[model samples]
Structure formats: structure tokens, C-alpha cells
Target: MLWLKERGIASVAESVLNSEELDKTVAHLLVAARNDGYAQGYAECSHHVVNALKVDWDTSKSATHGVNTEVALAAAKMQFNNLQLPVMDLIDVALHSEDHVAQLKEIFPDRQEDEDEDLA
Candidate 1:
């Protein structure tokens, strides 16, 4: 945000950043903690909820009390991780996107391969 502001490209930055797609989920036991004003890593859930609702992370809070995707993605990126921000504006681009997984691979190429293939 600061960097974009400096370059007078904040609008483009604003347009580029989407929070709903940023959250990572937590374990089941952590739900009560967040409800009482505390929540563990809700990345997967948050991402699911946000992605399901198709809302921006910043504004997502307006409709939900879940984790912030934009912040999550920022932290992930600061640690040298790559988060596939929507090229235009679509969460499907992140999940069903062929580019997203590739981007994530740049960081942890060996994180985990698709195990779903075996399930079917």
C-alpha cells in the first residue's frame, strides 16, 4: 500500500488486492476461540468462506468475522510466498486457476502434491 501510494499507483494496487482469497483455515477446536474474540489459523475455512461468497478481504469483514485474506496473503508473500492475486477479479482464478498452483510452487515446490487423484 505504501509503495503504491509512493508511486501514485494505489488505485491499481487497490484494484489488484483482494482479501477474501487470502485467509488460511484453522482446526475445529479453534472455532470457539475466535468466536470469543480469538481464532486460530482459519486459513482453509476462511478461504472457503470468502471464496464461496466472492467478496474482497477488506470488505469481507463487513459480512463475516473470519480471517482476512488480504492480510494473510500479504504475510504469506512477505515470507517469500506467492499468492495468485486475481488478474482481473475472480476467485475461481485462484482455485481453479492453472496459474495459482504454479505460483505457489515457486515457494514450496515440494510442499505437497495432489493426493485427491488417489481418492477417486
Candidate 2:
């Protein structure tokens, strides 16, 4: 956000970065993806929620009654790590996505042949 403002891209950044609708849509989509057996989709959504709660813990200055940041973050991370899977169908779908593979390629162009085979 600061980078965007520095670059004079505030309008563009605001339009793209607005999180209210994204949050609602993502929450809905997480369940949908889990039901549909899209592993990464579900995991990504679940991670988002976990991370958000952690952030809330860290940032809630007035919420003295709430759990402290360290404990909250630790719990959130543990829960994220231990979340039960949806169904096998969703797990199968979530484990593989061409888009994700492509992203991996972009990030690690010299990635191994075995990596390609696994994604294939």
C-alpha cells in the first residue's frame, strides 16, 4: 500500500486492494473449494483466515481481555497446521492446478524435471 502510494497508484491500488468484498467472497469460496475438493484453494483460504486472526491478535490494542499476540499467533499457526482435510475428492483437486504449476515455473525457472513430473 505504501509502495502504491509512493508510485502514485493510489486509485489503482485502492481498487485492487479493497479487502471487504474479497474477504466475504474468500470466506464463501473456502467452503465451496473445500466441498469441491480443491486442496490449495481450500488451504489458501484457510491460511488467510488463520493469518487474519493472527493479525487481529497482534493489532488489537484495546482488546485487553483477548488472548495476547504471542499466544494467539501460536494457536492460530497450530490450528492451521493441524486442520482436518475436506474430502478426498477436494483434496485430489486441490493438490494439482496448472496455474500453480505455472507460478512455480515463474518463481523457479530452473526447477527440476522431477518437479515438472510431479505437477504433471
User: Which candidate gets the maximum lDDT versus the true structure?
Assistant: 2
Clashing pairs in 2: 37-90, 38-94, 39-94
lDDT tens digits, residue span 1-120, model 1 = 232234324333444553344433222223433433323344446667789998754534543355554555445445434545554344234435566544333322231233555555
Q: After superposing candidate 2, which stretches have Cα over 4 Å from the reference?
A: 1-7, 38-120
How many residue pairs clash in all the candidates, one count each?
Answer: 16, 3
State the local distance difference test value for candidate 1.
Answer: 0.43
Query: Could you tell me the lDDT of residue 5 within candidate 1?
Result: 37
TM-score of each: 0.19, 0.22
Worst 10 residues of 1 by lDDT: 23-32
Q: Give the alpha carbon lDDT tens digit for every residue of 1-120 in model 2.
A: 232234324423443345354445555555544444443444456568778776532323533323334444445445545544333233235336555434333332332554788899
